[model samples]
Target: MRKITAGFFHSVDGVVESPNLWQFDAFDDELGALLGETMSKIDTVLLGRVGFEEWAGYWPNAEADQDFAQFINNMPKYVASRTRSQADLSIWQNSTLIEGDVIEFARELKAREGGEIAVMGGISLARQLFFAGLLEELTLITHPVVAGKGKRMFEATDPVTRLELKRSSTTSKGNVVSVYGLKPE
Candidate 1:
């Protein structure tokens, strides 16, 4: 079975919005190292149209030009969309747009051969997957500072769903990385 691995960056108080106001002079090698190690373990990359567009541009250029970006470029990516949205699909050499019944498509994708499929949170879509009981493992990488006003990761979009904690830890950057797996049957 294919599992979902999420790497989200949030605040101490649980927030996953963007951080554009921080002042940093140099890259935190420790944090980057930790993130790199974690990312190296995953294979598949799944994202919504918004998140796909956001990452397809940068990550493909940052990593070894063939590491993370190459993985994103060559590996399978399932993007959830309703209105035929294709934002720079060129970056993803092997990509497919998800329409119609997403759960079925996602399940089919999971059944195929692969290591771990990561679901990059776009908030709305993550809630959809959470409600559908399709998510296996969730990894939330939380940060230290809180954004008073920004987008939230998930807000109970479904009627009712439960997730049991699996593992969690604090990163060197004072960030908390929480891992959650859906309640087993």
Candidate 2:
């Protein structure tokens, strides 16, 4: 079975939104290596509607040497969106709008042969996949800063989900890189 993983650049205060706004100062070689390692294993990319729209606008036109530009731009992207149709995804190349149940589509995708399905930065989509038991791994690079305000990864009302820490390390810049697997029910 193909492994499904979601990675987030999170803050100490739990904010996962727009890490670029607050995370660049703390970015270092260690973080870059960590991200490269993660990208090495992933072939498919999954995105939520918001993330899809946001990324489609920028990554396509990004300079050739820009980080992740070539990889993300050329790789097949499956976007999970309830409101978007197939016609709407033409703005970006190699993007397919998932039809019907997102969870079911993911399951089918997992069953097929692939390298890895990566959930890039879709908070809502990642939460849904993680809670639905579709995501096999969750990796977080927690920077040593408190973003005063932004959308968080989890809500208080969300059902409790347990994770087993597969591995962890602190970067030179005080960023904590942690990899977790869902605890067996």
Candidate 3:
């Protein structure tokens, strides 16, 4: 079965929104290599409506020399959105719209033969997947700075989820990349 791995850029305070504002200075070649490695392992991308719209607007026009841009443009993308129609998703090449139960779709995707499915962004979608127990692994690239106000990666909730730390490494630029495997219930 293909593993669903969700990767997010987070702040010290657990903020996951707008990492570009604080993550630039902390981004180094080491971190870039790590991100590239992660991208190489995933042939499919899972995104939410917001992430799809934002990326579709820019990534398609991005320079061909940019490795990440090229990867995103070429990979098969599946966007989970109840509001977006097929026409909306077709704007991005190699993109598909997922309208029904996301968990069921994820299950079917995992059952298929593939390299890996990477959830690039979309905090709400990631949270939903985490709660549904569909995510097999999660990689949090935590920057050292603390963003005082932003959408947190994890919210206050009733039942807590447990994760086992698989590996962790720090880049020279102070980005702590931590990989976690979802613990069995």
What 10-residue stretch in candidate 3 is worst by lDDT? 153-162
Candidate 2's residue-wise lDDT over 1-185, tens digit each?
A: 99999989999999999998988789899988888888889999999999999998888899754769988988899999888998899999999998889999999999999899999859999999999999988888899999989999899999877889999999999999889988976
Candidate 3 residue-wise lDDT, 70-119, digit = tens? 89989999999989998988888999998689999999999999899988
Instruction: Show the colliding residue pairs in model 1.
Output: 10-143
Task: Return the top candidate by TM-score.
Answer: 2
> How does model 2 score by TM-score?
0.96
TM-score of candidate 1 relative to the true fold: 0.79
Top candidate when judged by lDDT against the true structure: 2
TM per candidate comes to 0.79, 0.96, 0.95
CA shift at 153, candidate 3, in angstroms? 1.2
For each of the candidates, the C-alpha root-mean-square deviation to the true structure, in angstroms, is 3.3, 1.2, 1.4
Expressed as tens digits, the lDDT of each residue in 81-184 for candidate 1 is 77655554655666678767877877887798878777773666676666677777667766666557667766645455567889876655566667787877
- Which is superior by lDDT, 1 or 2? 2
